[model samples]
Target: MQSTDVTQRFLFDNADARGQLVSLELAYREVLAKHDYPEPIRALLGEMLAASVLLSTAIKFDGLLILQARSSGPLSTLMVECSSDQELRGIARYADDITGDDLTDLMPDGVLAITIDPDDGQRYQGIVPLEGGTLAGALEGYFANSEQLPTQFRLVADGRVARGFMLQSLPPDRQTDPEQRAATWEHLSILANTLSAEELISLDNQTVLRRLYHEEDIRLFDSGPVIFKCSCSAERSGNAIVSLGREDALALLDERGGEVAVDCQFCNASYRFDRDALEELFEAAEERARGLH
Candidate 1:
């Protein structure tokens, strides 16, 4: 059976290339369930989710990777996040009358920002102009500008499932000849371009490889699970409230009838804080500050 909610890595044993395949079902549905997004928005968000997982696994890091896009078109914002552990959550904001099907139509003049925040090191971010009218195109531009690696991506989402295929040329350590390296990358990219959206979303990883690279030496890796998990909690909500200062926090509580409601946009999880909770939250924050001093 075709695997769902899983990501797998594959490598070309005979070429200086590697790739990743991601198929998401449950995680995609979970993210869509949080809000009543339009069909186009749903499809775009789904693609972003799949792309995030593909890029996350492609890199070596012990932190979070965020793909955020902003524009002046109907689709104002698109954000997808994936952690090193494969946990995923995403959300999109669009005008109610949104009817665009492609990135250019939906997010004209948009810019995509890719951020990698390592657990023990400095965070890094790269901004790429949203070119080629698709998420995959924008990402290819990012790799070309930042890593200077030849990369290509095929992404598809029908609101039911989201699937992605990424192929990148690794450093030419084994193949020192520049001409051969270019030829190899071109051959692999051409074959990968033949892959259809239907096949990518429907076939298993092994089948995908066999169908795409039947003439090449391919090395397939084990698959890993991808899940929808929002990193929101009462503690985090309380911290946000405390960050607003005790006076404003209490004022907002009063304005909202003695309670402040904090809602997580990703998961639709709500956290409510009353007078007692707010008072105690600030008191504890104050105590921590004093201790630090």
Candidate 2:
């Protein structure tokens, strides 16, 4: 049975702990649809995508989880993002002659940056050193240092799918059952580590969960849909131009044959804005400002 890109949260009824089973099939392919990434880079994207989704389910925030990294070596930047809704997207920037062996080595001394942005409040971001450790290790370190939780995660991204599984102790204040938390998290992780890329990319959610935790009493919640969507459009891109001011906006139009092209790096979706498009967008802003005055 084939599984869709489904992220299911499970709560140990009496164990006082929580977990998530995430399997990405078509969703992973959607992310890699148009991008050409090396094997290692593809694997990294898978890890980050799953990590981002895990973070979304673990935390109670309503916003975005962005995983970004920059290296001083060959692979300049690698990024992946997942939202509270389980929507995921990511890409890797590499040179034409990059090899799998060279890709992991490329970020020997880079920095891993994770940003948590809420829709109704200020955004917070954390950065950690990427010292020879994999993306999962770096994020685990982030949780230890920031949230101080005993978190175990397995992130897998293959050519066909990217999925991640996570187990974490409930906050002491939330449950106040230390023994229960330990037993639950430990048992779930013991089984979770057995997951393979083939299983994650192909099996159905129910089948995958049964294979890992058939005997456990887990309450599966509503799965938020996950998809490959670009939040870019001509109106939004032109608003960016308006922020840059009318002079710069006209300059861009002249530079790009009377139309400005705004491309989203994640999905590679382009939004084109010509003179008239820019004029309307700028006019709306001006009118709003005038009304405020």
Candidates in order, TM-scores: namely 0.97, 0.87
Per-residue lDDT of candidate 2, residues 1-293 (tens digit): 43477788877676656777676767777778868777777777777777878888887889888888998766778887788887777888876776545335877668998898899898989898875367777777878888888777767776667777777766665446667656666777778778876786677666877888788777878776677666667677767788989888899789889988888777788888889988888899999999998
Task: Give candidate 2 misplaced runs (Cα > 4 Å).
Answer: 1-3, 173-188, 194-203
lDDT of 1 at 135: 92
Q: Pick the candidate with the highest lDDT.
A: 1
Each candidate: what lDDT?
A: 0.92, 0.76
Candidate 2 worst ten-residue window by lDDT: 95-104
lDDT of 1 by residue, 1-293 (tens): 74479999998888899999999999999999999998888989999999999889877899999999999899999999999999999999888788777888999999999999999999999999999988999999999999898899999999989999999999987688999999888889889899998898888888999998998888899898999999999999999999999888888998999889999999999999999999999889989999998
| Model 1 stretches astray by more than 4 angstroms | 1-3
Candidate 1 matches the true fold with a TM-score of: 0.97
Tell how far residue 102 is off in model 2, in angstroms.
7.9
